[model samples]
Target: MSNIIGIGGSIHDFASCLLIDKQMNAIEDERITRVRHAINSSNPCQPSLQYCLNWAGLQLEDIDTIIANDDLLQVIDPHVYPDIVLVNHHLTHAYSTFFTSPFEEAAILVLDGAGSKLSGTNGDIRETTTYAYGNKNDVTVINRVFGDLKGKNYVTKSETLMSNSIGEFYRAIAENLELGWLVGPGKVMGLSSYGASFGDDRFISEMMSCIKLLPEGQFKININGEKGLIDKFFQIRQNYHKKEDPFRIDAAIAHAGQVVLEKVLFHTLDYLSTKIQTKNLCLAGGVALNSLVNGKIPFLTKFKNVHVFFAPGDSGTAIGASIWGYLNNSNQTDDLIRFHSGPFLGRPYSSDEIVTALNSIGLTYTQPVDLYHQVAHLLSRGRTVAWYQGSSEFGPRALGNRSILADPRNSLMRDHINSNIKHREWFRPLAPAVLDSTTAVYFDAHCLSHWMQFVWHVRKKFHKILPSITHVDGGARVQSVSKDENPSFYTLLENFQQITGIPILLNTSFNIKGEPIVETPYEAIHAFLESQIDVLVLGEFLVVKKFDLTFKSPI
Candidate 1:
């Protein structure tokens, strides 16, 4: 019974995870504190580790090996006791993707804002390392080696390093757009849907010009140096807003341009495929979160299979770090195959705890055995419900367990949820949690996205029907809920289907903008009172906040 603990603390999203004998037992992040991009903070991991250990019914002493995602031995102050094993950030990211993917062999891609650099006497350089574990029925190994993309093997090796990057460009574009300063690339993706084509020739020329101006490798131009670039790219938006009929022509053009860049990525992979000759492709890093790029893999790449770990961002480094530690310390062949699907490795709540929380708040509620029917009725009545159950998820997504539920039939619900409930940007679209079996009926994608990590085009026939969750580009980030993946969530969808003839529900993270997903019932109640959310369901207890009698809305 090997017990390994993983800890990550780099720029933002400090996190930790525990795996017992290769089975993921627990995971959590620091962002839950409502502190945006909290990194290496003391409050994040101490309690999280305690909670994880408790969930596994073990103590800290039970842990055989501790894996530190970042180089804590070097960065952290002395006196911190764990004295963890160190794992390279990129290797962990690669392992997290490769280990979790369903495919036996795949091309792995890891992209991030930036990774730690190992200083060579020659100069600063980017590295590309690959590790292969021997085949276990559940897990297979292809190769394991590490090399610098620069220096001796420069040309052939350079491809390995360049292939992993592309994210820096997106980040620069995001900064130029005046979106949120840190990690706002996702906003650029959302905004791209509004752009229009400016003719293929002109578009390609402009994009190529921009790429050419970019500093080579990791050398990024200062934000001030790139102001002119921003002005040029955004000219279309300024012009469009002045027109009588405003359209997202610029956005559409940008979207098309991004697609073209993604093709470059595919081309790079095609080149790599000639040597690796593996059908499976594994991707990690923040860039791997781009569902559009991920969705395009099957059609664009030479590899027949592609797999991306759920938390491909920096937060996932904790898990990757730990796994690397285990493999290295055990000095055993990488025989582990299957990883547990439940990212709900966070703290759990007991019924007594729920009861205590309700009583402390002086809330009136009834425990219902038929939770599905009860919650479905509230949603059907046009009430937004906060659903909290079991352990919290590991990744940024709330999944079903810690999600806010709403009826998708109402178009106004989208605006209401965004402005009044979630208080997020209007352009951001909500996600859909649909019964896994019915995904094919409504979406164009064939994969089952239990993690809500992929975007699929909503069938034209269902666009209007599910408008609240569908993006302007007719795509929806979808979580296909299965009984095997989450039984309670699955049953809720089943019951909702029985009542409304729709197997899908509008699912968004159970938090307002600028806050992490609610980790406790008290937090859920506080969010409910502060926001437009009408109903709160934690475990079996359902509480409805009493709003001002004069408050009224179409939703």
Candidate 2:
């Protein structure tokens, strides 16, 4: 059996993937290091690499080939390791989504803040956006856009008419707004819905004029130099913070940036539809994490079948590179590289490990006869639960395996969790974990979002009943649970349906802000105790707080 390992090494989001024959396992360094993005030295993700090896009972010497980015050779000697193959950043991103998808052929679109740096006529630039098409095992790039750095200003390369970059535009706005660098884009996306409430069109118009759709599925950002229009809005927000509408300017800027991004994506997808005959579309890179834009692609564009992998960001490049290596080494063309299983590709904790962790923490627990029934009843009665089961998910989302589940019927549940448990922005929305069979009953479209990659509008009739899960705009980042893939989560959903007449529950990542998702049983227990979670489910065992820690909302 051939063992291929893919390494995604950078200053941030370092990860490793192991493809043994057809089976695949992947994990980000952030999950093991307990850092948001695992900012580290230029090397392979050691902790993640160890985890993958331990999961499969293998060692470094056993790996037949190591596929990684060219940037990894900066710190270490290349001759010390096994046969190493270097691949480009955007090509790996393209392969991560397209190869994992069920589509035989699909148009691939990869858009990120920045990719591998290359020397240009003016200066060094990084790849920003790439369009490619994948047929069988071959992925061919059709067009590309580069983000050129001029002093402190980021812009498209000299070839494009617009000075700015489509990939970097939203990040620029987010940074100017002081939303932070690591997790700003998501906050900006969440803050967008409130922009229209202030009745301000100036920011929107100004932002729109900066971005324009170009030919050949390309778009450009043409903002002013250095401290441009985004900085102007930031200055405006400083004065607005003292007033009642503290987030008025911030919201407007976010909304404007979001509008431009969606427009560009829609235009690009339409162009791709005209170029490619297949109805399938695969999206990757950090920008693909925007569920709002991803949701609109299926309905707004000509592509009817859209596939966005679980780990579509930098973390997923490891899987992609590994797949490329695996396919190249194997002589069999009929053998397809795919995640035939699901996204729970991390190392799973055994029952003994869970028990040992509980013992070490001195936490009392009980294994109920019907664990799903008891947990579902607790949720029905308005108790927040930290559910830890099986292996951790391979993406930013916590899909059932490592999630905090709550009752969606409670209108105040969202605010309570935001302020108390998550310690995040109040405007940020929570997601819904619904039974796959009952998705059509509540949501407008019967889209099967198993990976929480799409946002669907909640049906008007169930809006009031499921207030906590639905966003302010009546849309929800939904994860439809299936019995075949996740039996425990599906059983819990079934039990929840029997208790509350709704097969839905509020779900979010099982971690507070500034930390990555909990990986080990120890981290899970620690997170449960640190927060106000009423029940902690570690496999079949249930643990609750010894004292009366009733949730009193600060809001």
Candidate 3:
């Protein structure tokens, strides 16, 4: 009966979402533009708003309310506006995750680069108790109530403002690396896995030097600036006589430092749960994407349940913002809606578009009903194919809907994909998209990651067989695919398995080096033609790129 639109901007990712009667219809962003977190300068929400409206079979005028995330409204275009409702970034993150999680009550920990303030000297460490309504008829729905973890009894703080944040710490580190603030944090995460822990003395000294642990809380020095935080970190590395490998001892120390930060947060939350007598927690924000840190929560916290939003990063804020708007304006608390799996809520391609692209590229392909079998045939022959079908994905990973597929059975395929297709860091590992049913056979069930989120030890029996996708540490970041979530991808894996007896495929983003993941058929085709990829599957049509095997190495 109602249509709500949510928009988030002026942050790292400009995103928008449409919720029809509390059901997510579509979600997308400006990153498809390849600007790397482009801010909406003019009518920032215009593109996404329009797209969402179209997808929902509605118009802007048909929207009942608009939700704006964080303090985006202050910077966004005022003229092109909807009846607005505003929500803090962290709370929005919590909402997005808790609402979607299978648990009715779970411990939520939302960590991000920066969001609207909650409370404390450093806003990064605000603890709160939130109760969500499951049924539309239920009336008691408080998004969050701030809580304190001083001694034994957790006291609710009505008026306390602070700004010390975990998000800033990571951002500062990314800036210090000269890897582009918003961009290189993941690289830092990967580099950290290679280093040794900073242990007690060194870790404590570094913490005291960089952050001041005050009576109320901690505060990090304002070290993030134009010169970048990574450069400053390198200077500190020089003082310690560190090596050139970004993955060296110093890098490991830094990674260990992050672990310490998470520990502090864990202790604070533990103390809080005892005082509040709540067994559930909800998490959101960019840092929630840190699967390693997330994996530690079940072991460290007393909370019985932990839930993180799928799109914990800024992109999800758009959905949060809109939901907040509807709740506040309507003054009605409704049942939390579940988000559909796969971020393929963006624009879809028409058969006409697919055919035009294939014809223009001057490539030969067949439109077989068994699309999966044909594509699998290409992979069985050691060919790499860019697969772009249905709607583009919403997050950083190419979750099958928009991905480059290669044979995981070939040990050298990782290098081929990285060098010729992705053109990313050689040290960086590729992910394997494995059939859900076969996941336990290849990886530890503890490593049964669904979103390419966590690293797991690959079974020794399959390590050499899938060396290209497996890491040197005997680990692989696997994305478990189910036919229900993504039928096309699942069927493709099944077909590939039938041909090669391997359920996993070398899956990487469908883009070249330094490019945003392919958003449209044109971008997908262009990348396929320019790169060494053997074929391009755009919807029903499959276009093969005929090229001589003779090629010089670019890496």
Candidate 4:
């Protein structure tokens, strides 16, 4: 058996994964550091690499191969390691999709910022990369669009980019709005729903002038596109300021950008569909994390099926690279090995760690006779609890395993969680972990969304009761929890449902604002003790502060 480790990410969402044949163990660097997208790059740190090795129950000498998603990322040690495989940035993103997806043969599309530095003049920025066909055995690349973006000294003074990159356009929009480039499109998506749609508002459509469409579906952004959009926003700021609502202009701009993103992508998909008859698609890259845009693809385009792997952002490339390394070498790529146990691949804490942390605070706790049932009982009483169970998830999302959950019916919980708990924007919405079978009853979910990567509309009737889980636009980032995938987490939900009529919970990542999702039992306890977070559920033991309601607002 060979031990293959894959590392990915440069600027943000860094992760490492160890794949022993079909079995996989992975962890994101942010989890260990407790920073939302740690900045240290140019070399892989010991904690993350060692975590991968420890997950595989291996030593330094036990590793047989090291695979980095980007060769020029300067993260992996080239000379210190003998057997090293460096896959291209977009290629690894492609592998993450085809291999993780159920389809044996599928079309792959990748969209992101310039993943790697540009090489040619015509292909200035690599915005869209596509793998025409893929099977369990191999993926064939018929189109490569990522190597087009010119960064650094790669382009001439006159040439800014190979093509008008939707990613760069979106980046400009996000950066201009004050959300850092590293922050994904989530905040924009949240804000977009609060504004008027193009058809409903002439002002929103007027903002689309910057994006220019050319012959044969080719497009370019005028030099004035980014500046014009921002300038127009500021010019009209006085009008919005005259109004009571502070977010009026911000929401309008977000709505305009969202409209541009969705429409342009829909047109691109239609154009591509005309060229290729294949209906199955596997999508990857940072842009794939845009659930607002992703949710519309199946409906807007001719494609019948679209598969986007969990951790589609750069963090997932580590798993993709390792999978590529093993399968490419063995030539058994066609028969893709499914990464079972889901993406909760971080290191598990032993019972010893849990007990030690609990004892440190002199906190009294009791292991319930039935952990799931008792946890459900606590939730039934409207107790918001930090639940830490299995290995932490390896992405921006905190799927049940590392989540803070409360009663979905409690509408006030949203504001409470936002202002007192999460310390994020008051406008940001929460998500729901619904029973897989009952997902359609509450959401207009067309397919099974195991990961919260798709936006599903909350049913009209449930909107009033499930206000915390439902966004202002009626969309809920839905995660349909399957019993087979995570039995323990599913059981907790089942217990909660048994106690309450609703199966959904107001779920968010278990951490204070600006912190990464809690990784270790120690971190979970640390967060629990520090924040207004009501209770700490680490493994079987649940600890609560004596004066649970006595904390000051984190906001």
Candidate 5:
């Protein structure tokens, strides 16, 4: 009867997971504290740990173990932890996804900024892209790739050779392009689609010179670390910047970086596939969040099967570390995927609780004749609704339960949400939740992506119909929802389709710009009050705050 609690904090996306016997409860610190990435905060994971303990009906003493992914555990109070295991940072990322993957024995790919040091010291940094072979309870490393997560949170020339550190290259390019840190990659992914697909006369030469794949299947770079690559990138970008359209330069830069990243990853995966000879591949870490690169792996390599979890970054390491501890310590025979369950891993309130919350918020509410139909009707009329139902989601992306849903067909809906509610960057692409049956007809995703993890091409015909969700390059990261997985969300989509003749809904997370998705009924109501959305659905309750709505989108 070992109750394991896993904590991952510091820098960004802090989280805690409680694995009690057979059930697993996990939550991100951003959701509870209403912060963006849960960065620069004191006492980072205490509130999240407290919530996990309360939900599991256990206390500190009842817990058998707590695991952190770093030797220097970035904890609020290390004294509270009597005996916490400092698992290797990369191992946590690796086992977290591979152990929970559907594959019995798969090729594991763990690529983040810089993995933990092998010696856990000042200068000892582990490999960045680590390939492993795993079966049942044992996951063994088979190959290592070029890169480092040691210096300056990324591989710097001071620490390692300026080889194929893909994460650092992307981050640096984005920062020089004025996107700042890792925030611009998603936007650039969308932007790259709009650029010429790396023409012969394009900036591909410079990018290749900076990041080259050798004949021996190694990625090398001649550019000096840090400022050297940035200088060349800015110089090459200046050619496009001279164009009348300001976006031309930025789009070209994004396209160049994406081209280099794709080439390096393809080479790496191909090399791993040959060595491991496995049909299944498991991907984890911050770099795993790149859906564009992920979609191409199967096409370029021998691995036909690929598995990725929603929270593959630092935040997900919490659950991964806990699950790893479970497999290692208990009699469990790798049943993580079976017991993994859905991502709605937070609090689920009852109808009575919803009523009480609505009353407390001083809002006029009613349990409509059909909650799905009512919300569907609002979406049909191009009204945005904050949908907070069932339990909160565990990852950064909001699936269906906690979402701000709108009509994807509305050309203005994207701008409407941006200016009115989210206040997000113009380049922040929107996502859609389509009926699983209709996924292929609308998107050429090549596989099912219910987690909004892969970018699927919106068919030519459906492009105009789903403008709000469609990226400039005609691809969108989509969630294909089926009735069995989520009945209410599926039904809402069905009803909206019956009315608007479209089965898709623009599903952005349910929150404002600088905050995480709403986690509770009260938080949903609070977001509704702060934004200009028309409605808020908390379970069976449909609430409308008595406030004047005068703000309008400039679009």
Candidate 6:
């Protein structure tokens, strides 16, 4: 009954979502521009907006309403479209997770660096933490914590605004190590496990003093105290040739931060459950991306069900905006509709396009009769395959559609992929895509991490068998693949299981370090050639690259 486009994001992760009646399509601007986080504030949202429109086969005029977060005004002028509906940033985030979730009613928690400017008695404040409850179509805010950081400009203000942010606290630790804020949190998360061996507990304890945990899950930061600690122990000096070792002070700091983050999240969720009294909980915003903390929520919190969609960061705000528009303007008072069918909302490429890209690249490919079995055979033999299929996923993860697959049974596979394929820090861990039925058999958690949002412990018996996917802490970010959600990926896993008595594969994003996941066939082919990937599966056509087995050094 309605056609709406929802735009969300601030200076980074700019994205757009199109909702025509109940159907939806979304894309992130960084995927199109090939820039991580779409770093430029001046960069228009046209690319992402246009992609949604094109995917829906509609024009701008066809949309009945345009919904966007108030922060997006920095990118697009609201005056140009005077009727555009602008919603608060944290509210949009709440809408994104609660609506797509299967829960009819659930508690929503939004944690980010900062949200839209909020009214404050002292001065304007930014929202860093929010608690809300969504019942049917109605979502009501229960509580919110505002950031006290103040300045004239956005950049200067955001730094202080995030002082009370757990995500910011984690990122600050990573930035202190020169890993940068964008990808640093994950890198630090991986490095934290190494701390127990080479960590400094005194330093970690001193760092913990910078935070004061208040009642009801709120935290007040002693920024001055934290800065003094950082200046004394974390400052990098000039003429430093090599990066710090992961087993030294860096690991200790990461470990301490990781523990603190878990404590903060658990403390907050414990209080939220008391107020909402709901069996279901929904999480959004940047802080929700920490799978290690997320994995432990079910056991730690009163909530029986935890739902985190594929795209939970700022990019997901677009989906939330669209949901808000439909609920408010479509003449339905209490309609709760789930519009997502997994994270495969991006546009899909046709076989013709795949053929053309391969031809143009002057690479010979074979149209395999049974693509799944052939790829399974290669993977079982210790070959790395870049698997490209259907529409790309809409999140930071690669969910099989755009993934690098290898045998998890190979202990050396982790090192090989990190060094040769991803070109990332060795400390980073790879994830696993396992059959849905066999997930409980291999992992020790009860939550459904189908979107790879939570980390689960690998069973003790299987730890040595699946070393490539297992992290240093004996945990693996597991993606439970169901036949209904994705048949092709499921069939491939089934085939791999039949060939080798294992139902798991080491899965990582299909792109190298510092690159957005490959969007087009040409980009995929280019990445396939640039790296030491053994095989490339583009649709049904298979392209093989002759590479030496010495690189793998099979164990």
The C-alpha stretches of model 1 lying farther than 4 A from their native spots are 39-44, 54-61, 70-75, 78-81, 121-164, 196-204, 212-257, 330-336, 546-555
Query: What does candidate 3's lDDT look like per residue over 269-363, in tens digits?
Result: 65456444555656677777766566556556666466555577877878767666556555444454445444676878899988887778776
In the range 331-421, model 4's lDDT, one tens digit per residue, is: 4333455554477888778888889988887788888779888878767666788999978887888888899998888777888888888
What are the candidates' C-alpha RMSDs?
6.0, 3.5, 6.7, 4.1, 3.7, 3.2
Deviating ranges (above 4 Å) for candidate 6: 80-82, 120-124, 150-161, 196-200, 224-246, 333-335, 548-555
lDDT for 47 (candidate 3) = 64
**lDDT value, residue 144 of candidate 2:** 79
Model 2's alpha-carbon lDDT is: 0.81
Query: What's the best-to-worst order under TM-score?
Result: 6, 2, 5, 4, 1, 3
Residue 24 displacement (Å), model 5: 0.8
Candidate 3 Cα RMSD (Å):
6.7
- Pitting candidate 4 against candidate 6, the one with the higher lDDT is 6
Ranking by lDDT: 6, 2, 5, 4, 1, 3
Task: State which candidate has the highest lDDT.
Answer: 6
Task: Give candidate 4's root-mean-square deviation (CA, Å).
Answer: 4.1
Measured on C-alpha atoms, candidate 1 has an lDDT of 0.67
Would you list the C-alpha lDDT of every candidate in the order shown?
0.67, 0.81, 0.65, 0.74, 0.76, 0.82
- Compute the lDDT of residue 88 as modeled in candidate 5: 75
Model 1 root-mean-square deviation: 6.0
Candidate 5 per-residue lDDT over residues 345-381, each given as its tens digit:
8878888888888889789888788878877877776
- lDDT for 216 in candidate 3 is 24
